[model samples]
Target: MSFLQLLIIAIVQGVTEFLPISSSGHLILIPKLMDFPDQGPLIDVAVHVGTLAAIVSYFWRDVWGLARGGFASVGIGTAPAERRLFWYIMAGTVPAVLVGLFLKTGGYLEGFRSTTLVAINLIVYGVLLGIADRFGAQRKSFEELTLKDAVIVGLAQALALIPGTSRSGVTMTAARFLGYSRFESARFSFLLSIPAIAGAGLLAVLDLADASARMQSDAITAGALTFVAAILTMVFLMNFLKRASMMVFVVYRVAMGVALLLFFA
Candidate 1:
């Protein structure tokens, strides 16, 4: 890919990956609209790595805590909040993993990338997020998270297998609906993403191996740029959610969805 193409792809992947906008949807639409060549497997893997690195870097403290807590909990038992949170993240990942495995095995996920389906989901889930944010009790924080919360959020994440459903968006919506505060809801969502993103990257790596995919000439440059963009976007989004509601994202999703439908229709 050209430098300009990489720049655009990096920006879209970085922003939408965390902003409650669908990264997969944007990646599909933007390239089509701009008439760019297919990004191919190497670029896909690079961007995935970039976003994964961003999330991991941003949440390193939590990642460390989870690692230590998980190991210790295996022996002494999981009694501390950090240890419990570790387990909670694991619990939250199960539903999505199971659902993703099923979809992959059945070759169902690729077909769901239809523009019409993406447009419909964009509007539908946008409204769902708005409703949850507007009416949710907003009384809970990360410290107060429970097993039930994780499972419900995890189940919601399963729906995100569909293009435009947005893994972050659905999980945050579920967390909000379960009464978590906006920032804390987002925190949990981001934390939950670590395993999910890692799993996805691993799958992509295996696919690359199977296909004997070769890296683009500028793959390193593209990956580095994407990583920088993703990290900045991740930081900005986490801070933004701390003070704002999901209303802006809701409006954006709905508007984009409508535009997409009109254009495609």
Candidate 2:
């Protein structure tokens, strides 16, 4: 890819990664529709690491608390908010990590055509989201999230491996359905993403090492650019998420899905 393509891909990765629209889905569908190579496995990891840095920077306070809480829970130290949420985030991540391992290595996420399935899921999930908010306007905040709810949300997150299911969207939707407020649901979704994305990125690093023996310097540089883009995306999404309406994202997802379907057809 040219520097311009690298920059554009990074920007798109950063923005769409946080949006309710599926980032991974976009990585697949956008390339096919626009006639570009699907970004390589190593690049996926690199971009994820960039996003991880962004989330950690933005939510350092929460990260500290979760760390303190996680430590304390193990009888090491004391931090209050750190207790359940720390563990809950960990619990929520387990299913996705497991599923990701199997699918990533088992060839489950291959075939560019799966993006069509993703687009379909995006449309269907968008409708479900509207119905969910209409009927399940939650008054409870993230503070009220239970271990059970966290686990369920995590499971929903695991299903986001499907092209258009969207990790953030699915997790937020599930949280809302379980009685969490929109802001809380959104916050928790982002929080949960930290570990999941980080884990994925770490895996990519290993793959990149092997690829480095065969891949050119330019490929590595491109991946670095993608990583930078992911970081910017995480920053923009987290802040905008605080104020953006679900309606906007819902409309976008539906429109993107429809566009993909038509274009592919």
Clashes of each: 0, 3
For residues 52-141, could you state the per-residue lDDT of candidate 2 as single tens digits? Answer: 676777778878888888889989987767798888889999999999989988887675337679779889888777666556666877
Against the true structure, what is every candidate's RMSD? 2.1, 2.4
Off by over 4 Å in 2: 213-244
- What is residue 248's positional error in candidate 2, in angstroms? 1.5
Which portions of model 1 show Cα errors greater than 4 Å? Answer: 40-42, 76-79, 211-213, 216-222
Q: Each model's C-alpha lDDT? A: 0.83, 0.75
Question: Looking at model 2, which ten-residue stretch has the lowest summed lDDT?
Answer: 212-221
The prediction achieving the highest TM-score against the true structure is: 1
Model 1 TM: 0.92
Clash count (model 2, backbone only): 3
Where does candidate 1 have its weakest 10-residue lDDT segment? 210-219
